[model samples]
Target: MTTLPRSYWCHRDFDGPGRGRLELQSMTTPYPGRAVTWMRESVRDALTGLDRPTFGIAWAWLGNHQASGAAIRELRQGRPYTFTLPAPDGHWTWSAHPVSVLPVIETCANAPSSRQQLVPAHANGDPP
Candidate 1:
């Protein structure tokens, strides 16, 4: 498990053209855990350069039994997760949260770390 300060900037990506689309910065130690996810549109746009929605939440990391998951906010469909942005000292400040953590967490649970995010930096090695 990762460690967090009592308060830190939190960012969660919303899945649509609303409050959930832009990056958010907030502070949350959490009563339990937070839901974070990538919008199907954002990642799809980023990956294909076509600007479309490609995926949805599948699963997430809670403790063992362990399916003890909660929404980032009540009634919110956001996918909760844990991971902070990196600070200057190589520390991840708790900013830039995802809209859902489900797919990433489940992916991590099975795949090797190096194989994750299996795609070229750019289809042709240029910035998106």
Candidate 2:
């Protein structure tokens, strides 16, 4: 078996009682800091041989996130792998730059309250 990163990427999810219908905007990232979770489908389509990439994800850190103050919850199949992304001064909670790293994969960033709050990072924090 191939030995992966000792510290693989974890995951995070944001879900609340949808006021309208049963909808889920799932964005799973890594923990202990700002990381990314590469799903099975993504791996197959992108990394091919790296399909079963249990390496989890690759992300920045809580301090590296934007100033959105987004809410999230950590989850796992086995025991809960708990950790924290220390917040920087004034900066909001840990946000992610999805498309920044790879292709297709998009992440959430912070935007204005009145305007569209959800910001999608390009394949490298670029524009859509």
Candidate 3:
């Protein structure tokens, strides 16, 4: 069976107090050309959803599953890096510069640890 390149990110509810959860996304391309096309669309879609110019970086840590904790640390330290995906002809590399690196919380499910805790919104009363 062929394996696909995967990516992960930690997500937390900014409106409430809770441990973050790990989110996974994967992409598989049979050729170098398709790999480049897939990555470009994926990155573009992600950037479009965000209101800012920053983006997060994730690497494939396991056999098409999980994220690399070591790589995340290196990226957090402001190190320049790139992730390469192998293809039949060559390879595809993707890199990004994020405004901030969000911390990943160790949790099996996406549930808050405490129900009584609630985080305050922004100072301007804007919904975060």
Candidate 4:
């Protein structure tokens, strides 16, 4: 169980559709390559449950330094609104708030795909 540095940060974004992206980075210097690799794997493992098509396409990326302030602002306004960086041991996690990002995950899982929206409307011009 490696201890996550205090400088660690995570960002999550939802495209309002079924797509979502997650990025993890660290602000501290001398970042260990092994630690970064572990972090990436840990994130992938954490999101394995969202592999279903209903969850849409979820992608995780690794960042070098702190994410831009603009990106953070945009994420805060999105469905995720918060994120967590968990240690590989699953014993500890860090976040600004106590809330989990599950709401965003669930939203993506339930969101209708573009193909589903292409259905023809009823006589009244309303969706059937």
Q: How close is candidate 4 to the true structure, as a TM-score?
A: 0.22
Q: For candidate 1, write residues 68-104 as lDDT tens digits.
A: 2333442133334443222222222222233322222
**Which residue pairs clash in candidate 4?**
none
Candidate 3 weakest ten by summed lDDT: 10-19
Steric clashes per prediction: 20, 8, 0, 0
Candidate 2, 20-122: lDDT as tens digits = 4423233434342333223222222322322232222212222333411222222222223323322221111122332212233343345335533355556
Give all candidates' CA lDDT scores.
0.33, 0.30, 0.38, 0.36
Tens-place lDDT per residue, model 3, 52-126, is: 313332122122222334445544554533454443333334543223334456784676666334545554476
Top lDDT hit? 3
lDDT value, residue 37 of candidate 4: 40
Please rank every candidate by TM-score, starting with the best.
Answer: 3, 4, 1, 2
Q: Give the C-alpha miss distance for residue 80 in model 2, angstroms.
A: 2.5
The predictions' CA RMSDs to the true structure, in order, are 20.5, 21.7, 18.4, 18.9
TM-score of each: 0.20, 0.18, 0.26, 0.22
Between prediction 2 and prediction 3, the one with superior TM-score is: 3
